[model samples]
Target: MKKRWLCLFVENEVGVLARITGLFSAKAYNLNSLTVGTTQDETASRVTISLFSDDQLFEQIKKQLNRMVEVFKVIDYTDIDIYRKEIMFLKILKCTENDRTFLFQFSEVYGIRILDFNKDSVLIESIKAEEENNLMLQLLYKRLDNPVEIVRGGSVAVEAV
Candidate 1:
C-alpha cells in the first residue's frame, strides 16, 4: 500500500468532524494523519487527511467521503504537488550546561529552532514534513540522555497553485 493524501471541504458545524472520523472507524480504515481548520469563508472547514491504502481502497474512500452531505468537495492530492508540514516540539529535561550548548549547536545544523531554554531544560521546535520529523525524533531519542517530552500536531497541506 502507498501513502495517500486527501483534502475535503465541508460545512463548518458541530458533529461534522465526529461523523467523518466515525465513518473511518466504523469501516476499519486507518487514518495516518488528519487535520481540520475553518476556511476564510467561516461557513466551511478544510479537512486534510492522510492514509496508507491501495489504489482501489483509496478510490472507495473518496467515493464514501463524497457521499457525505456535509462534504462540499473532495480533492485527491495523492498525485499532486503540495506543500505539507507538521509541527513538533521536543523538550529535554535535566540538561547540563554542556548539553544545553550542544543542543543549541545541534539546532543550527538541523532546521530546528531553540524555542526556550533554562539551566536544566531546553525546548526545541521543528516544522517539517512528517517523514523528516519522524527521523528527527528517532535521532533525538538515540542521542539525548536526558528525559524528553514530545508534542506533535497533525500535518496540514496546500496544493500548488
Candidate 2:
C-alpha cells in the first residue's frame, strides 16, 4: 500500500465533519491524518486527509467522497505538487540545564523552535512535513528520559502554484 492524499471541499455545516469521518469509520479505512478548516468562502470547508491504501482502495475512497451531498469537490493529491505541513508541540519535563542546552542545539539544527521554558520544563514547536515530524519524535524519544508530552495538529496542504 502507498500513501495517498485527498482534499475535500465541503459545505461548512454542523455534522459535515462527523459525517465525513463516519464514512471512513464505517468503511474501516485507516486514516493517517485528517485536518479540516473553513475556507475563505466561509460557507465551505477544506478537509485534508491522508491514508495508506492500495490504488483500488484509494480510487474507491475518492468515488465515495464525491457521492457525498456535502462534498463539493474531491481533489486527489497523490501525485500532485503540493506543500504540506504538520505542527507539533513537544514538552519535556524535568529538564536540566544541560538537557535544555542539548534540546536547543537539536532544535536549531532541525529548525524547530523553543517556544517556552521554565525552571524544570521546556516546550518546543515543530512545523514540518509529517514524516519529518515523525522522525523528530523518534529522535526525541531516544534522547530524552524525562516525561514528554506531544500534541500534533494533523496536516494541511495546498497545491503548488
Candidate 3:
C-alpha cells in the first residue's frame, strides 16, 4: 500500500481530535502517525497524519472528513506538494579510549552532535530522519561492537504547493 501524508486544519474545540480519529476507526483505516498542535491562527489547529492505503479508499476518507463540521481544510500533502521529515536520537555504546577517536570521526562526517555521553553510552541527535536510518544500517554492517538505542519522532509534513 502507498503511504499518504495529510495536514488537516480544523476548528479548535473539545473532542475535535477524537471526532477526527473516529472517522478513521469507523472505516478500519490504520493511522501510522498523528500529531496535533495549535496553529499560528489561534482559532484553528493543525493535525498532521500519516497512513497507508490505496488511492480509492483515501479519496473516500477525504470526502468524509470534509463533511465533518469541525473540518476547515483537508490538504492531501501527498498529492500536490509536501515535505515530510522525522527526528531520531541514537545512543551508541559507551565510549572507550580506544574508540573515542573513531566515534568523533564518525560524528564529524555525519554532522551529529553529542547530546549526552557516559562511559557506557553516548547519545547522538540527527535532524535528518532518513540519514539516521542509513547511519544505523552502516553501523550494523561495520560491526561497531557497540550497543545502540533509537528514539523516533513521527513524520511531520508541510504543504508546498
Among all candidates shown, the one with the greatest lDDT: 2
**Tens digits of per-residue lDDT for model 1, 57-159:** 9999999999999999999999999999999999999999988998898898887999999999999999999999999878877877899898988899999
Compose the digit string of candidate 3's lDDT tens values, residues 1-161: 78887889999999999999999998899998887889999989999889999999999988999999999998888766776666777777756755656666777886777787766677777776454557655874495777677787777778665
| Model 3, global lDDT | 0.80
> Clashes in model 2: which pairs?
none
Residue-level error in angstroms, candidate 3, position 153: 1.4
State each candidate's clash count. Answer: 0, 0, 2
Quote each prediction's TM-score. 0.95, 0.96, 0.81
Please give the TM-score that candidate 2 achieves against the real structure.
0.96
Give the C-alpha miss distance for residue 75 in model 2, angstroms.
Answer: 0.4
Positional deviation of residue 21's Cα in model 1 after best superposition, in angstroms:
0.1
Q: Which stretches of candidate 1 lie over 4 Å from their true place?
A: none
The segments of candidate 2 whose C-alpha lies over 4 angstroms from its true place after superposition are: none
- The TM-score between candidate 1 and the true structure equals 0.95
- Winning candidate number (TM-score): 2
